[model samples]
Target: MPGFSFETAERTHVGCVRKLNEDRVLSRPEVGLWAVADGMGGHQAGDLASSMIVDALSSIELLGTGYAFLDEVQESVQRVNRTLVSHARLSRPGTVIGSTLVALLIYDGHFACLWAGDSRVYLLRDGRLNQITRDHSMVQELIDSGALQRADAPYYGRSNVITRAVGVNDRLALDIASGPIQEGDVFLLCSDGLTGMMDDDEIEAVLKARTADDAADHLLKVTLDRGAKDNVSLVLVHVEPSVDDTLRTARRTLLA
Candidate 1:
């Protein structure tokens, strides 16, 4: 399979109130791996947990078909989960040290999104935005079960309470979704810091109006402007036509 090339950008901020930024972002376009990890154990441990997650993923070297690559990505995440769990038990027993993970893997015109927390993966195609990953948070559960209305989620005070996260437990359950990539599709991977500050509509507008590079910066700026209470991080990817397709079009234009 011919590999699909992409335009990618990422950003992270400490926010106005936080003394330290616990959020970590990885943009390895060479391996087509991008991720955002938001740590949750305060200053000392939160940064450590998030950085560990990014380090583990960055060390992965996948050289196979798309599905095989996806498998390796999942395995890598699970391996890090176990490692973090053990480290926490030995170093800081009874203290929670975990991070929320959301990752995107693109290969051979195929893309896979894997996540474990409120951090999200969104696909913007044909001017419409679709969320590819669901939030494993307490408020999401309430909205799903009809206890809380979707419109009222922003007002909920406990929106930060996530039900699942990486390194939080011995057995980590990640949600994975895969699909074929389309030309002109834009994939947005972000931490809750962005979502907590802006609604879906506001996010969509920014994504629609800006290029991937500009979009990442603008999103972070907007979040900070709105009082980013927590660490903010995001990865933006713009999918383009394959090399073969672009060359073919050029050839036809030459003949014409």
Candidate 2:
């Protein structure tokens, strides 16, 4: 945030099979906060869960430090978890209201990704793509344990069964990964809707478009072309030096 700025490209759509889109996306470049949430439940209950999360996050204030920002975000999400859990308890038996959460936080030249369930965050640095968040799903576990092959995960029958999510359990556990952000680094936050339609290689190629906006649009269009079976949502964030920083670099080069 000090000498860097962010540009975001985002979209959310109801896929071919779904009538109502259960996915929600938040792109707050000014606050350096962005997220993608995919809700899971029948009869539009998914919408409620995803919307509640994005609404809660949409109002966060970046306080003292980067660490405080992280804490506030985690607390806000946990609060929503409690609220949803209570709501489900008050409803009929076997009523499940839950959603996956993947949030990208940037502050003072640093970045952090907080998530639960199968949604993902990826970083493309120096033209090389790497997935930042590991999925919390049955298929992922099987792949990790060597019971299933990485190439076969997309076709895994139990792919939809996630191990963690808000509203699914009273104690919502979010995993956090953090590091310093670099200029030209691009961060992608998306629901499984996109990943389900393409492998990492395919996604990496698409993200290599001339601009972040182009890459984001192309990603969505490609998913729809593949017969997106679930609600699709994604946010592509491009990092760059601020105007002042760029000027400073130019000045130094001229002086040299």
- Which number leads on lDDT? 2
Global Cα RMSD, each model: 1.5, 1.5
Per-prediction TM-score to the true structure, in the order listed:
0.95, 0.96
Provide the overall lDDT of each model, using Cα atoms, as 2-decimal numbers.
0.89, 0.92
28-143: candidate 2 lDDT, tens digit per residue? 99999999999988787889999999999999986889989999999999999999999999999889899999999999999999999999999999889999999999998999
Off by over 4 Å in 1: 1-3
Candidate 1 per-residue lDDT, tens place, 1-256, comes to: 4446789999999998889999999999888899999998874788888898899888889777888888888888888789878878887557778899999998878889999989999999999999999999999999999999999999999999999988889999989999988888999999988898898899999999999999988998989998999889999999876688789889999999
- Pairs that collide in candidate 2 are none
